[model samples]
Target: MTISSTPEGVSVQPRHIRFDVSDDLKSFWHGNNAFRTAFFNALSLQFPDGEQQFINAVRLYRDRIEDPKLQAEIRGFIGQEALHSREHKSYNEALKARGYDIDAIDERFARHMKWVANLPPSRQLAGTCGAEHYTAVLANAILRHPEWMEGATPAMACLWRWHAIEETEHKSVAFDVYRECVGDERLRRIVFLFVTWNFFKYTFLNTCSLLKTDGKLWSVKTWLGGLNFLWGKPGVIRKCLPDFLAYFRKGFHPWQHDNRRLLEKNLKELEAAPSAH
Candidate 1:
């Protein structure tokens, strides 16, 4: 968690951290809560390919960025996301080993990204910007609220906490690239609208499929508990509403919300602790 000032002076240092996602990890890794666990598992299914899409989208404009610091941040962003894809791939494989169809979920996203690739580069990058904003806000929620990961196995917990810190570290890299290469504010906002709806739509489908596959979809109590986790007291989606809405402002930057306090506090906690045994 050491922060190094690069030659360009941006604080983005890609820490090549690794975690031990052992085969012993259960399918319902979140304290046996199938719905909660499937929600995170569904997210893991997206990272391997989704992260590569982020890298490719930003790399599209790598040659055009004139700012030295932003360039350095882009490199860091790519490196961090690459490791994230690798680690999440390993995590997904572990779930697949536990007899879940996570590979199908992973492939579904890959195919979807392939279709997205056919769009104009600006639109593709705008899609990446939209997704990055989601990750940044979601990461902020995890860091701000320890309860989100409260009952996970140590390895899964370490993996997510590490991802959240790095996501926050380089959250603005793709957006900056989009603004640099294609400063189409209207398109950016429009793409976000499309991406947001599609994101939640896919998330719900994937999560419900996972839940149904695991037999939790039939349980009224499971549905109630899951709903409470997402929309009840300390509701993460509710808490993130302001930040989410802030994205539509004519001129919006991720740092304007300024969750660095949470980042610093969590970074120290992570560095002070050992990885999952």
Candidate 2:
């Protein structure tokens, strides 16, 4: 992927750090861990290919990247994304083993990506960046909403928790990369924010729909539990949203949150816990 902005201008480089997921929380799904299993299965099927497309979109001008620093950052970004997709693939297998409708989920998910990939560059950038905003927000919310995972099914909790940690950790890389690569900041922000709010609404609402479809809807215990655990907690939004919106401001940095502490804490615990089959 080519980054128009170099360190001479701007770009996203790789940072080494794996997120820690709590063993206790691994099993926590909204209701049934299998519901989450299915969701993940779907996500894994969609992401790698979609990521390639997104990468290709950036590659549209790979040779144009004149800045060595920015080029390295782009390589790092791609490497991390590749790692993420591979790890998720392993996780998705666990979901299928747990009896998720992985095939069905993948079929539909592939269709969506196909549609997304067909969109114009402007729209594609918006969707990708917008989705990043949601992930970034949700990631921070997960860390702040520790209580939300308190009683979740262990496997499911671990999955989302690990993903959240990584997302939060890498939150700004894509946006910053995009800003450095693409056109006017003002236009990017407008499209970015617009895609963001809409994607968020779609994701949560769709998650609800999926839960119901999978017969996990009545898991109100999990539902309300997640809410109270995450958004319901004091300072949940404060800890997260400001970071998200702060993107509009100069000198905003996701690293300021330093979620690695939480990841490390969880990893030690996972290391001690028995692995789930």
Model 1: C-alpha RMSD to truth? 3.5
List runs of model 1 lying over 4 Å from the truth.
1-10
Whole-model lDDT, model 1 = 0.81
Measured by lDDT, the strongest candidate is: 1
Question: Candidate 2: where are CA atoms >4 Å away?
Answer: 1-53, 141-148, 151-170, 218-223, 234-239, 247-277
Q: List the residue pairs that clash in candidate 1.
A: none
Q: For residues 1-277, write the lDDT of model 2, one tens digit per residue.
A: 4433322212243334343332322453445454443333344455555556556555554455676655665576676566666656655555555555556655655676777678776567645655666666766666656664554565556555556655554455555555565645665667667665644544454455556556777787656644553355544544566666765765444454555566566545645544322
lDDT (0-100) at residue 75 of candidate 2?
Answer: 73
Cα-based lDDT for every prediction: 0.81, 0.54
**What value does the lDDT take at residue 131 in candidate 1?**
95
Root-mean-square deviation (CA) per prediction = 3.5, 5.9
How displaced is residue 273 in candidate 1, in Å? 1.8
lDDT for position 30 in model 2: 42
TM-score of each: 0.93, 0.64
How high a TM-score does candidate 2 get? 0.64
